[model samples]
Every structure is written in C-alpha cells, then in structure tokens.
Target chain A: MNFSYPEFLVKVSENCIKCRRCIKECSFGVFSWDGEKIKINHEKCVACHRCAACCPASAITILKYPVSFKENHLWTEEILRDIKKQADTGGKILTGCGNDKPYPVLWDKMLIDACQVTNPSIDPLREPMELRTYLGKKPEKLEFWHDKSGEIKLTTVMEPQIKLETPVIFAGMSYGAVSLNVHLILARAAKELGTIMNTGEGGLPQELLPYKDHIVVQIASGRFGVNLEYLNSCAAIEIKIGQGAKPGIGGHLPGEKVTEEISRTRMIPAGTDAISPAPHHDIYSIEDLRQLIYAIKEATRYRKPVGVKIAAVHNVAAIASGVVRAGADIITIDGFRGGTGASPKVIRDHAGLPIEIALARVDEQLRKEGIRHLASIVASGGIRSSADVLKAIALGADAVAIGTAALIALGCHLCQKCYTGLCAWGITTQKPELTRRLNVEEGALRVTNLVKAWNLEIKEILGALGINSIESLRGNRERLRGIDLDEVYLDVLGIKPAGR
Target chain B: MKIDARGMHYRELNERIHDAVLKGIKEIDIVNVLGQRYIGTGIGEKVTINVYGTPGSDLGAFMDGPVINVFGSCQDVIGNTMNNGKIVVHKDAGNVVGLSMRGGKIFIKGSVGYRTGIHIKAYKDQCPVIVIGGKAGDFLGEYMAGGILVVLGIFGREKDPIVGRFIATGMHGGTIYIRGSINKSHVAHDVSIEEIDENDLSALKNIIQEFCDAFGITDPNSILSHQFLKLRPKSHRPYGQMYAY
Candidate 1:
C-alpha cells in the first residue's frame, strides 16, 4: 500500500503567545512556532495529547481526519471499546506500537487461572519459589579421568555463563539515548533486584561501571562506546541485531542530545549526531554472525554469556534457530509493541511481528530441533501484568523484558512523547529539570513493586497448574487453553479450546 | 619465537595463542597467518606480538593491554574492544574497525574497512585513536566520543578525500581531522565542519608526522598541504524540550 501522511491537523489557537512554552514542555517536537502561532505538525505527533494537556490557554484542538465510507469501515466498535477500557481503568491510556491503536493485543484474549481446588496457591513470603535462571550453552558430554596426581580431570568444551536471580531483565537503553540519572536508577535497581540492565548499543557510562556485574553491554551495528573493559565488565554481552519498535532501521541520536557528558559516555564527539546504520555492514550471513558470537566468546575467555537480541519478524523462528546455531547463549525477541525513544511512525507501526506468535513458533521450532536448551529465550513487547508474564513463560519464554511498563512504573504515562525528548515525567529526557520529576528512589521502589507483584502472580499461576517451578511451566502448552483463537494459533500453541 | 599459522583453523590458532600467552611469551611472531580470527582477543597484560600475514575478523577484539603489530592486511572488527595498548597494522584493515573502544590506540598504515571508529570514545585518561594512513571506507568516526582520529590519505599524488560518505555522522566530542576536502552536503545538521587552520594542524602535526615517520615517508609537508576538515557537535542539549509536562 502506498504510504500517505495523515490528513488531520492539530493547531493551537491565536491565544498562544508563541512564548515557546509548548516547545519547553514537549518531549516530542510536535508543536513548533512557525513565526506566528505554535504550529502542530501532525506527522511528528504521537497523539500523546501531552501538548493539549499542558496547553495553558486550552486553545489546542486535535482534529481527526474526516472519514468517508471507506475510512469509516476501518473503524470497529472493538477498537473504541479497547480505548474506553484503557480510559476507564484510570483515565490513563495504554497503547501498543508507535501510537497506532488498531493492532490486536493477543494477551487480552488469553487468560490465566487461579489456584482453588486440587491445587493450593503458595504464599511467596512463606514458600520460596526460584525465579533464577542460568543462560548459556550446556556441554553435551564430558570425558573424565583421574590424572597422575589422583585428581579427576574433565575434558569438556567450556561454555559461557550468566546467572539471573529473576527471569525479568532490563533491556538495552543506552546512556546517550536516555539520561545518566536514568541509567543510574536502572543500574541501582537491577543490582538491588538481582537482575541485569542492558547498556544499549551506546557505550557504558563511567558511573554505571560500578554496577558492571549487573549490566549487559550491547554491541550493535554502530559499535558505539564498546571496548574490552566495557565488554568484560558486563555479566552478558548483547549483540543488538535490531529493535522491535523500528526494525530494519538504524538509530540516530540527534546532535542536540549529544551533550558533553553523553558524548563522553558514548565516546563520540559532543554535539555531533550519532547515527547507527540499519545493518551491521560486515555481518551479511549467519556465518558472519557466528564469527562475531565466537569472537565475543574468545574476547571474554568464555566467562560471560553472549546474547543476540532481534526484533520479532515474519521469519523470526527461522532467524532464532540461526542465532542458536551461531552460538548465542540467549536470544531476546522484541515484539512490534516494544517502545523506542524515537522512531519514524511508519516503521514503528508496520515493520515487525507480534511477540505472542513469535515466541510460540520459536519455542516449537527449537524444541523440535532438540536444541531448545542451547539458548534461553526472553520475550519483550507489550508485557503488562503478572498474568502476561505467566502466559509468556507458558508459551516458552524463559523470561521477559519490559520497557514501557518499567517506564510507567518510573512515572511514564505512556504519552508516547518520548521522541521529542522533553519527557515531563523525567524517565526519557536528558533535561535536568524534567528528569527530576522521576525521583530515583520512588522509581526504584515502583519497579521493585511491579516485579514483586509479577513474582506473586507467577507463583499463583504455577499453583493453578500444579507446577512447582517456573521451568516446569516453560514450553508446557498443555497447561494453557486459548479462548477464541483461530485453528492455526490453537495448533501452533498446541492448546485446546476452553471446555474441550 | 616464531609460529607458523598457515592452514590452521581459527579454533586451533586461538588455542595456540592462548597457550603462548599463558606461557609468558611476551614477544612472539607468527608467519603465514591466514584468517585466524579473534587473535589476541581479551588479553589483560601487554604483549608485543607480530603477525606476518592477514588475520581474520575481530583481531585484538576486547583486548585489554596487548600490543599487536600486524605486518599485513587484517579483516573486520580489528581492535573491537581494545582498552589499552596499540594495534599497528601495516596493511589495509576491514569493516567495523574499533567498534566500541573506550581506550587504547589503533594505528593503521593503510586504508580501513567500513564504519571504522564507529562509536569510539574515551574515559578520563583513556582516549582511543584510529589513525588511517590511506583512505577510509564509509561512516568513518560515526559516533566518536572523546578521542583523536586522524585519517591521513597518502595514496600517492592523488588528492582524494580521506573519508567517504557520512563521515563523522554522529560525532559529539572528539576531534576528527580528515586531511582533504569533504562534501559539505553530506555533513549532518548537528555537526559543524570547518577548515583546519594552522593551529589545529599544529596540534595534530606531531601525531601525523609520527605516523609518516613510521611508514618511511620523508615528507609530512605534502600531507599537511591539503586543507583538513573538523567536525564537532553543535549543541549540548541532545534533544530539545519537546514533551516536558
């Protein structure tokens, strides 16, 4: 289909003084002074309604495109119902993809059962349930024999390793993309929570070096700020193949955000635009990927695990299998619903596949190949409550990474205004004043609370299935039942219909 | 010590290098080196190593303090994560060279691969340098942090630009001195490109002259004859105030 710009326009009335108030308030550059009144560029707008909310004159109105019979047919009552549901929850809107609200959230159709009869729910406080998981390749065989000194020596291929106290991990958000304070909070929270936070393709900050043990340093196509010390310091090294929000595209940190501190942290010259190309120029084939994987293994001396994170696409299962064979200890699949600091609205909406089907297919493929244990799978994109976490595990995910959810816990309203970088909530912006809005203490607490709640829900789900551990539920499709899924989904998930 | 690595597999080469380093062999030379990937990767201490022939991808990747001197052409990701020490390559280097270096210096006597010095940065005292004696491929110094990158295009008498399209695309803090003319349209809005004056040339002359001195060039004069281009960031505020509540 031919791409066309949205027909609707948003404008602030003549009442606006053009004092650049909206400019200062917005994180996304939606409204700009056109030498007259503040002009609203609909193309740049994420429909976050942040500008409308912050407008003092209340003169701004976002007009929707006039719908002819053809356009009106595209609208459904279900879409309106979903929007209302999000509004009814708390007047807080939840959305997936780059502000486009038409996509289906498969998680809503899937439900989790609670323990009542035959199985009893375990109190997480009283009974200890392990969420910890080890990510790495396991040796198939070991040849052991007693040496001349009477000590047993084993000849086994050394495999890399990374230990996680919980299945949840903080995904890659670079120091340059966000703020130093945000990285600090994530690092501190990850350390305290016994999880790991990723240093997105941007280089690791010096402040984050202290928490290196809990960091997953990323090396993307741009290869920003990566070095031996940065690689060695992290518990895991993630090769960022692509991001869900904007797949098949590279990243560009506008020259405006390349501050001195960020520049120093990222090792780029300050004030210069940081552009990450769409693809790793050198990595053309799976063999090249394998070379990089083994290269990292050789660099770290097989001490730390290596992860390859790619956006969920049409051929994700096949791609994941290649990654496994390429020697990745873990594969992180990001769904189309994943968040990004800034991405072209077009790419964000239509590029990648949904996480639900992607996870199931990848799991089924790997299990069939009998190489499922070769690497752990972590799914991200549109993960909301503890039930979603449980469903994901049952669908064959070892863990999940939450970006927008974590930001919400840290006071992000999901206004989808991250592109402009004026995040009033302070979670995404580099502005010092706006950044203070998100108190690190409270942010950490909220994240901890979210994880704790999810942990409890996980235990509850396990109890209902009569499973004692998370590993038991992983890839255990028999415990799940799809409510109104299609035959293809039912077959792929290997689940029966309700009451069947 | 001499090690002949002809026809040796990547794994075997890695094992031999590991064993040699472990044995405390500080200065060793390898002959007929062919496609031995990940050579001297992640070594902590400094070692004076020499390679006679081509080394494969990720050579000296994540190296801590090892000084690797390559006598011939090298493949992709040379000095991938090199922190300290140096990698002096006598021949052309391949793609993604010095991917995410925080420290150390990479001196190439010949042209380099694509995206060379992409996201290269520096800490307090650890500044990384990728000095290419010949022309560099695309995206040279893409997201450079706080290091000095000098691309001295010394391919005979021709006066071609040292870097290709999108050079210093996202450069923020460091200095990149390309010793030739750059297409101004290719420069990003965030960067300010200016002609290198005597002051700037003087600042980098020592390094440029030192590079020429190593490569057996008699004149650093012709190298400085051409005008140099410098790219720097325009603003400290990465993203303007767009969505502040």
Candidate 2:
C-alpha cells in the first residue's frame, strides 16, 4: 500500500567482491548480506555516498530515479510525491538542511570588480595581505590624553572584540544536532585558524571546555544549560532571536534523542523533550531585549562582547538598528537559505529574506543612523566559498559565518535527512555505532585544511582587487556590480548594474 | 558592609556591589535602593545582600551562589536564570519572577503578577522552587518543564481566585501546588489535578516550612489546614505526538 518512490536508484556492478564492508559502513542500513552476496535496498539509500566510498570493489553506482508520471508541469513529480507521502502518513512533511527551492542565489548574480590598466592588480604572493579582522563595537572617535607620568594614554573606553585570523567563523551547531565528534572537529579547527565556533543554543559540553576561548555560547529562548558558569567560560555571548531556516518558529529536540550526554549538556532530564519557545517570553519589546542584553553584560562583568542573531526578515534594517541601540556589540543576520537540524518544510523553504539584500539594507540603515560603529555585522546562511565571503563583506557584512560549508568539510554529503538522527557519515547522528565512523583528529584536520585553503583564496581575491586589507573591502559596494538583476535588487544591494 | 544607594545610577550601584564582593566583603546592606536593576548580579561568592527599597527588574540574574533578602517589593524577572541561591522578597513582586531559573529558591511574601515561575527547569540535584504567599495572575506556570511552584493565596483579595486563567499551559513537567480549590476554567488541558498524596504532603510540608522560616510565620500547620490541590502534567511529552516525523 506504500505509494512513495525511491529517490535514488542504486545498482551494484559486476565488480562486486564478497567483502561485506559496505554493510558496516552504511549507517542507513541500505545494504545487507544474504550469506552469499550483498543485497541492496535501493529505497533506503539516502545517497550519502558513505557505502560507495567504502566499497573496496568500486561497484556501487547511484543515480536519480528516472521514472515520471504524466508530463504535467503543474503537478510535478516532487509535488506528487509529497502529496502521496501526506496521504499515506497524514502528517506534515518535515525536512532538514536549507531551502532546496529554485530561489535565486544572489551571490551568483553579482560580479566583483578588479583593477586593470591604471591601477594594476598586485600579486598576492609578493604583497602583504591583511586578512585579520575584529568583530565588535568600534568607538565613534579616538580620544587620548597624557598621563601624569608624561605618557600618551587613551581616555575613551574600548569595547571587547573577537579577533579572527580569516573573517570566517563556524556558525552555531549544537552538540545534539550534530555529533560530539563534529563539535570536537569544529573546536579544533577554530583553534587552529584563530577563529570561533558558536555553541548553538544547546549547552557546551565539558569535553569542549578546552576550546572555550574560541567559542561563542548562545542563549536562546529555551535558556538551556545557561548558568553563571556557562556564561563566564566562553569568549563571547550571542542572544539567538531567530534563525533563517525556520523563522518565527521554535525548535523541539524530542525526548527519544535526549541521551545521557545530551541531557548533561542541555541540563534537562535524560529522556525529556527540550522545547525552545518561538519567542523569548521575557523579551516582549525592544526595551525588554535591552534588559536581557544588559543582564548578560552585568553577569559577565562587561568583559565579553554580546551579539544578537536574527533572521533576515522584512524590516530587518529597523530590527538591526533596535538591536544595536539595545547595546548589542555584534549583529548576526541569517539569510533565508540557512541550514538547520530539523525544520518544517513549509517554513524552511518559504520564509525570511536573502542575506545579500538584508546585509546591504542593515549596513546602510545603521550608517545613515550614525550608529554603524556601535556593532559589527556577521552575515550567515548560504556562504559557499571564499568568493561568497568576500562578496558578503562587500555587501556590508563585517564577517561571514559558515554552517553548511563547515558541515560539508566534516563529511556531510547533504542527504537532507539529518532530522532522522541517522547520519551515515557520523556527522549528525547520536548512535554510537554511527558516531564512531567520524574520527575527531581526521575530521579536524579536514576542516582545518578547508579553512586554510579558503584563507588563501580570499587573499588571492583581495590582491586581484588591489586591496591589501580585508577591512578596506567591508561595505565597499562600489567594487560590486550586478548582472541580469532587476533595478529593485540592484538598488537595495547598493551596487551598480553591469555596463552602467 | 553598608552601602547607601541614594541618587546612584544602577551601573554605579552594581559596580559598587561588584567591587565590594571582590574585596571579600560579605553581608552588604544596600539602603535607599530605588529601582536599581541587576543588584547582586554576577556575584558568585557566598555573601548576603539585603536591599531596603524597591529594586528594579532582574535582581540576582545569573547569580550562582548567594543570598539576597529584599525588604520591599521588586520588579519583573527577579532571579532570572538563576543557578543556585536564595531570594526572599518581603513584599509583592511583578511578572515573570524566577523565569528560566535552573536552581534556587524564591519566596515572595505577597502576591505576584502574570507568568511567574515560567520555564523553571530542574536537572538532577538542581531543582528551583518558587513559593508565592498570595494570589498570582494569569499563565502562572506556562511551559514549566521542571521544578516546584506553590501558591499559598494567604493574602489574596476576597472572592478573587487563587490564580488567573490559562494556568500551566504547555507545561510538560514539574508539580504545582495551590492551597485552595482551583477554578476548572483556569487550568490548561495539558495538566491533571488530583488530591495531595502522602509523598506530595511531605514535600509540600518541607517547602512550606522553608517558606514559613523565610517570612517568620508563626504557625506552618495553620497554613496547611486548608486542603491543597496538586497539579502535574498529564504526559511528560505533551507535544510528542503532534510532530510529523
């Protein structure tokens, strides 16, 4: 009576050996051994490529299922499949990862400007390129006074700032959402790169305490595992207002997934559900948000920077302005295509604005209000490459946080089934047998390599533009030009159209 | 150490408290404390803070270990996300008291506003307890996952119910004890009401004894004379079946 169809067609070639290694490697139980040869259940194959990579004989060939229904554009195959699933289960369709819709990726529609004849591009190999950036509030003006001992001294107080070797940070990924091995890898990579990794609303585990200096602990509506010790141990704090993947909604980590380790970290019962409310009940107004911000500052003794993260919704500029005026040292804007552990398909695919437009509008609004220096902006969601990072900076972001990219670096094949808690590559699962597949040291090295490579690519881009410092490119919209984009987008991005 | 907080800004008052706590000063008496927010905040030491006047919102927020005794009424969010400590307010308080508090004990001598003791959770040995001496407003324990909440309704107005409407909405864990009968319309569907059992009576007795000790009440048995009703979540996972996956 099942009406669902297999998304992938997995075929084992004639080169198959009776090794049976694929059985242990496949976390989704897609392959089985019949005592003579290996049997494949193509229906269960998520196409994570874990078994394919581990197959010694190189026999597995996975392809998209090429059967179709009546060729009606209105009722597409994907829509029909979804309808069948709903009809069978009588449940709403749930999904993981970012939006898979055919929305325009604004980063691809923008081109970077480079120097040519008059201002020749400098070679990155020979010239010094400064990629070191700081994320925090900057003073409006510098004031200095001589001390009584005849020494020049600064009179204005300086706010706390987080230093980044490369303007890239690992976005918030909770330990419960991903594996502990993934958190370990992210922590190690952040340390090696001199950057930060955010502990998304889930509490920090004791094992990750060594990298506390390079970690940003998040405080969301749930207030999970948030205590004085948790606050004082981290380098910075982030008040998570909303994430782009599921804007205007909350998160629910089911009771079945709350293992002992996760329970200890989140400070909840071992088998109880951890529910995060959609909005912070205490924060009903901007003034209430300010109260919580100052409360955190007060608890930390004003020693650490506090950032407020919000999804890129309409009127994001005004919201960002209020957040800055509410005494946040940093602002993080998550675009519509942000990744998530689990979100309703309806909310994930159809909610929030793109980071490009939101970043530009927020930056311009903050600058127009003469309060741009009050807080730094960190753009997140759908930053794929070093080019995207550079382009995000030019679009008015102080830095960019990478979530999905970092997960990919740690061996996520993007099967979009992370909510099932059965990640084959050991990146997102809590099962002991699956989590063991991801080695901490090896995963850390891979992520570190990715970050280092991206750093070089960014330096090369900077040199091509005749800019030596990354800070020089921040909010420098003149260096960007739109291609095949409408006037409204171009106007909001504050960039000129090509051939203008 | 006795600090006079007259005409002092909240930042200055807090800084003074921090400086004193760092200097190993215990038992601070902050007098004339008119609307000073976040008093005793960030103080992890085993000191005592006694405030005389009306304090502002978020008193003892994120305070790990300390004892704060307020002589007058306080604003909203007192003991917000507090880890471990004791806060004894002699007068009435505002909304959202003891919000998201993981561990500690808050005893309000008089009534409180709406949403008091919301989202108070307990893990292992750390259970937060909030005891309201008088009636509470609407949504008394909404989204409460764990911990203990008791409303005595000792000083409530005549014919005004002990708590307002929509009590314990979205609550999945924890126990709520009210001194008198509850209005059926005021309770949420997710909670179940029952008569107190032997174990519940013992637990409530110990909590009421502590509440009596804090307010210097003469007869704890007299307060326990009224029949108490117990409220607990019918199911630990109220929304467990609501999700599709």
Candidate 3:
C-alpha cells in the first residue's frame, strides 16, 4: 500500500566533520541518530536543500535517483506514480503550488528585444524608467463643457482606477491558506512597495483593516466573508470566475485548516470545511455575471474598480471581451502554471493553456474590436522573474500577479506537498507550531527585497529597449521575436519569427 | 426622508437612496418602487428603508447593516448573500428567496415562489434565517450549507402542500423546519426528516415571533399548532471524493 518512494538518494561526502548540523537543520526529519552513525531517511527527504544549505562542513550531498523506472515516453513514470498513489491512498491525489511537470514555458520560447546599434540603449543606472501604471478602465473619448459662469470643465466620465507604483501585484491568497503572519507580511510589503495584495475569498482580517487601501478583496461563488464592509474596505473587488490551477473546479479548504482566526476572517464556524461552488449560482451566463459585477459596483457606490479573474481557457479572447463589455474594469488571466493551496492533480497537471498565447489573443481581440481601453489586462500564473514579467508585458499584459514566486521568497522549496498541511516552512500550513517558524519582520523584508530586485530588473529591461516607461512596451509585440516557433504560433502570439 | 420612485429608473433611484443614506438619513420611505432591482443594496448604514410597491430582485444583496421593509412583494433572489441586515416583506415574495444568504433575517407574510433560501449559509454568529409565512414551491432550501429556514404555511395549509418537491436537496448543513408534515418522496436523498425537538422548537419560536410581529399577527401560538418537521443533511462532505485532488 505504500506508493511513496524516495526520489532522491542521501549521499554523505568524504569531508564529513560529524558536526551533525544536518541533523538539526533538516525540517523534513530526514536525519536521525542510529547507534553510532547518523542514519538518513530517504523517504522523508523532499529535496528542499535545507540541510545542504545549512551544512557548514559540506558533508551532505543529495542526488536524484538514477532512473526510478524504465523511462517510457508513452507511459511516463509520473503516470505510474499517480496510479500507485491513488491505489495507496484510495483518495484523490491532492497537490499544491503550481504545475511542476515539464511543459512548454512560452516565456522561454519568446525573447525580449534590446536596443542594439540601430538604437542606443539607455543606461538604467543613470537614466529614469517609469514603471508606474494605473489599472482600470480608461475613457475612449473625452469631452468638455462650459457653464454659464464662463468656466470650462472636462465632462468625461472616468472609471475608478487603481494606482500601482509598479506593474506587479501580489495575487490573492486567503488567510486560511497561509498564516496570519504571512498575510501581515504581504500587506506590509505591498504597502511599502506601493502596490496591492489581494485578500482572497477570505475577507480582510480585523488587524489588517489598516492596510485596506493596499488590499483587493475578492468575491467568489461561496461569497465567503463578502459583506458590504468587506467589499467597501478594499481598493478593488475581484470576482473570481476561475483560477489557473483548477479552472473548472471549486475549492474545498478542509476543516482541519479552519482554526479560530481563519474561522473569524472567513466568518465561518471553526472546524467547518469551506466549500466554494464551481460556479456562482446567480451567474448562470455572461449576463448573469454582468449582474453580479454591476451589483458589486452598486454596492461599492462606484468607488472601486471591479476585476474578473479567469483561467486561460481556449476561448479567452471571447471570454475576455465578454468580461470587458460586462463592465469589468480589469481582467486577470491565470495560465495553466498557476499555484494553489490545494487542487486535484488531474486538473492542475492538465487543464488550461499557457498564458502567453492567451494574453496576446485577448489583447489583439480587444484592440481589433477598438475597445482595448475599456479594461486593463493582468497576466499571472507562472511569472518567475523580471524576464518572465517583461515577456508577459510584451505579449500584451498590462501587469502581472505573482503567487508561487512570493511564496518562494519566503523560503518555499516547491516540494509540491502543500495539501499535506505539514509545511515546515510555515508558508502554507495554519498550525500554530509550524506557522510560528516564519518571523514576520524577516519575511516582510525578504518579500520587499524580492519585489525591489524585480522592479530594478524590470526598469533595466525597459531602459535597454529605449523605452522610458513600461506602458510603451505593452502590446508592442513587434519588439519581440520567437525562437524555434512555427508561423502559426508567431501569428497567434503576434510576434515576428526569428531571422525575419 | 420620503421620495417618490414612480418614474425613477432603478439606477437613478438607487443613487439617490445611496446619497441620502450617506448623508445620515436614518429612515427613508420609497414610494412606488416598481421593479427597481437591488434596492438598498450596498447601503452600509443603520438606516430603515420602507418600500411601498413591488420591489425588484436582489433587494438587500451584500447589504451590511440596513433594515429593509417592503409593503408589497419582492420579485426574486431576495436577500441574496445578505451579510447582516433585516428584510421584512409584508407580502409574498418570488423565487430564490435568501439565496446564498450569510447572515440576517428575512420575513415574508405570504407564500413564496420556487427555490426559497437556496444555498443559505451561516458562519460563526452570523447565521441567516428566513421565515416564509405561507406555502413554498419546489426545491426549498436547496444546497443550503448553514443557517435556518422556516416555512410556516400560515395560509396554504389545506389548499396545497406546505413546501413543494425536492425540499432541502443537496443540503449539507443547517436545518429547515416546515410547520406541518412532509412526504418522503418530495425530499432529497442526502437529507433526513425528523420530529422537531424541544430545543429546535424553542429556537424556532423566537424567529417565528419576529416574523409574525412584522406582519401584525395577533397570536404566534395558533400558527404553532401543527407539528413541525426538521430536514437536515446527513453528510457534511457529500462530494468529498468526487474529484482527484
């Protein structure tokens, strides 16, 4: 019944000093004492490098297993493992974080263009590059009127806008999924970075109400903690239609994670499972979605912009346009590689399409219809670094949301065991003992440092393109070139093929 | 503050209502509120809204802390996702009553349309309760996860069924109490019907009295003459093993 096997082999180097630091620093309980020698438990190792990173004597060496099974492309080892796992647990294979299997990462296929001899590259160290962007609907046309007092005034109606010092915003992660300290760290980091962090379906906690302006509250099918105050307290509201990790499925946070604070924040009874329905019972169709969107607008008195987050399905272009026409000020598309606290492995590993093509399709569809100004498009899911961010922007995303990267900044090794409720790093678990591992002050600094570094790299890329502002690079697909891509992909991506 | 909503559009009427509420208007009397969708929605104040004519669907959806009093009936989806508020309908209401309601109380004087209190949820101290005075149509309290729903059948006792087919279908949590008896074929598979206990009746009395008082009932005991039936979900995680995680 034991489907689990060691994926890595624990190798002890000849330089072993017997300091036993590995025994102390290994959080996965991989090292133990057996009589005279320290015994290594290969079954417990998740290859997180905690012991290796902390080893002062350089005595610990971990190596991946040499061919767990005969590598058959048709019947891959993952498929066999999944089958075995199902047989062992007799339960659905639950996974966390993003899709870890090898798939086509479109960002690596497409390249960011820099100014060469034809154009002089601006030095980012000395020159100024603006990354500030406003996310919301923009007026298609402006009109002015003169009153009887002889004073002229601009009479154009404006959509509520969200101002971001940088194009990146932290994706919505519920309080129950992560610890309260993690939420505080994210809120403080976002405030310091002059950006926003979304409070997922869970409402804003009482202590985090002071950071309301930097938070974007969400309303999903479950309508968890979605009250007038919860909606009005945030800078914006996101109606979660779907997510990248599990596009068609709903979310079920187990009762074990619903502790006291989580219960209060989500406004549910403690030790009760929170089940988010797959679809909004009210939103039967696109028009139904429009009603909810306008309902939120009316509820907020039109003070905050409303965004709709959807997965990158096959019909993203049409779906994006529908969302825009339905009065959404922002459209967030989460690609197939998005992360989650818990999702069925079947959908996470094989569900939605890559975001690069989806973003290009949506942007082109909107621009071709001459209604691109109606909403800002945000790309998310698998944004790893500034290079990925730049690639996403060039493909037509106005901004990006990062979830897995933010978790990694707080020391997540991406072991993909997030559903187990035993994260030693304290990033995913809600248990007090495990959550206490993260120091809020240090975690906030790490998140801040990550954002700052990414921002600096973004500015450098924009400067190298001779573009002074990030806006100039948006939807400029011509500035990008595709490597080893066919004509169909190039046309779909709206980018020129290499050696054109 | 009193306003005539005879010819006003729903958006315009809602705007004026929001403006008045923002200006600290404690009470508002809206006359001729015909088909104005989402009345008093998003109004986050301790104000009272009195409606004269037929109001629209979603009358206090996502409402924070306002008391809505309707002199006439509501169309559909009343108290949809209502957070903490009171919606008192002096007459009968339409379909999907209290749909996904999280908290607060909804009181109706007469019969309701189909799918009353569907997905009515509750958490912690914020438990939503809906009291329908008369008979209800099909799928009453369908998919209800938390909170309480009571169909008094105050008027339709002899003429029709107290509640219609597929009652409490897909319900995982919460309790639904009908003033009279129910048939086994009309209920959902996951839910079970049982005799109302002393504690359940005691808890339901407070909610019933409030509903009766809203419609100016002389005696609450007369309505409690019939034995009550309670329907609750047998399993909390009914679909727990449907999908592979």
Candidates' chain A TM-scores: 0.81, 0.98, 0.93
Question: Candidate 3 chain A, which ten residues in sequence have the lowest lDDT sum?
Answer: A1-10
Clashes of each: 36, 0, 4
Chain B TM-scores, listed for every candidate in order, come to 0.91, 0.98, 0.96
User: lDDT-based ranking, best first?
Assistant: 2, 3, 1
Backbone clash pairs for candidate 2 read: none
| lDDT tens digits by residue: candidate 3, B1-245 | 99999988888999999999879889999998899888988877889999999988778888878999999888887788888889999888988788888888998888898889877888767789999888999989877889999988876456788898988876889999988888889999878899988899789888878877888897988877678989989987666665453
DockQ-based CAPRI category assigned to the predicted complex of candidate 2: medium
TM-score of 3: 0.93
- State the weakest 10-residue window (summed lDDT) of model 3 chain B: B236-245
TM-score of each: 0.77, 0.98, 0.93
Candidate 1 residue-wise lDDT at A362: 95
* Residue-by-residue lDDT tens digits, candidate 1, A249-273: 7877777787888777666666666
The Cα RMSD across the true interface for model 2 is 1.3
Which is the winner by TM-score between candidate 1 and candidate 3? 3
Q: What is the lDDT of residue A179 in candidate 2?
A: 90
lDDT of 1 at A346: 56
Tens digits of per-residue lDDT for model 2 on A1-500?
Answer: 66877888888888988788888888778889898888988889889998888889999889987675778889988789888878777776788899888988999999999999999897999989999989998999999999889999999899999998989999998888999989988999999999999999999999999999999999999999898889988989999999999988989888988999999999999889899989988898889999999999999989999999999999999999999999999999999889999998889998999888899999999999999999999999999999999999998899999999988987888899999899988888899999988899999899999989999999998988999999999999999999999999899999999987
